[model samples]
Target: MKTTFKKLAMPAVATASALALVACGAPADDTATDETMADETSVAQEPGTIVAVAQGNDDFSTLVTAVTAAELGETLSGEGPFTVFAPTNAAFEKLPEGTLETLTAPEGKEQLTSILTYHVVEGAIDAATLTNAIESNDGSYEIATVNGGSLTATIQDGNVVLTDAAGGTSTVTATDVAASNGMIHVIDTVLMPG
Candidate 1:
């Protein structure tokens, strides 16, 4: 009985070690079985659309509301593959008095739409792409937004920062949030077009 238990424990320890190595990006040992390695590395797929990703998070409720009010819910929910710089609820709160409320109003839909479109670049741009673009462009990369304006991107203090058309600068607080349709980079400030 003791010999049987010892044999079982040795294999369990080896399996745990292999999983730890895989997580650290170490090359798997030739002795590691294919089934165990596969199980340890599998990741569940997330939803595809930008709208779906935003709607799933509480931090994006304000953004979701604005998108709906701007009548862009359908557009964003479409086959976008768009890169969105999403501003959180707290970011929206930083706006002047009555700004968010007014933007969501029926009368302000067009304005709201413009503001939202200003945050979207046509393709999914990950952090690495932005960094590469910046390097190729002499430390700053200009990105054209859906609103027809441009944003200047640079790396500052190790974070990706976007300078809007109005010269307002917003730092990306989170990056590379993946969706099947595209990617999302969360910003600390709501970017406005000039």
Candidate 2:
């Protein structure tokens, strides 16, 4: 399927806007705005964006490579309050043989971006918020993804489990890894979108 990214704006322009906001003085909530600005600024001035956070972790090498192949580094690094369910290297290894190669190849860029974006939600959803959502929504909550897909989240054995569009499951190994642009929850499998 062809995936047209209508949600994400140009990363360069987003970054510039962030910088300009900081330069021009922020909103009325100076304290809160300062904190937000710091987070966004760190994404560019320091290794603090979601992309940078993944690149720094050894286990996310495969994810990093896929993001690079998809040319989504800038977008993921931009001023986003995104929530990402990051799959580890072991997760990528679990894909059918040669799947990784295809996803990372130039021809596979579209599918790769779609898959990558599927793991992301528009807002920063922390573990507590996720658990609350699950509890409040009749034991399962449908999380809308950036790729125009949905992931059903439920609690299993005290761990958060995500059901992809293909009905594949991924357990959240770690939660609430903070980034300049958002939060990252480590998942054990790569989520497939239907």
Cα lDDT tens digits for candidate 1, 1-194: 00000000101112221222223344456677777656545522334478877887788899999999998988888776688899999999999989999999999999999999999877767767777877777778788888888788888998889998788999998877776567778999999998
Give me the overall lDDT of model 1.
0.76
- State the number of backbone clashes in model 1: 1
Candidate 2: where is the Cα deviation over 4 Å? 1-47
Per-model TM-score on C-alpha atoms: 0.77, 0.77
Model 1 residue runs over 4 Å out of place are 1-43
Model 2 TM-score relative to the real fold = 0.77
Clashes of each: 1, 0
Output the number of the lDDT-best candidate. Answer: 2
RMSD of 1: 15.8
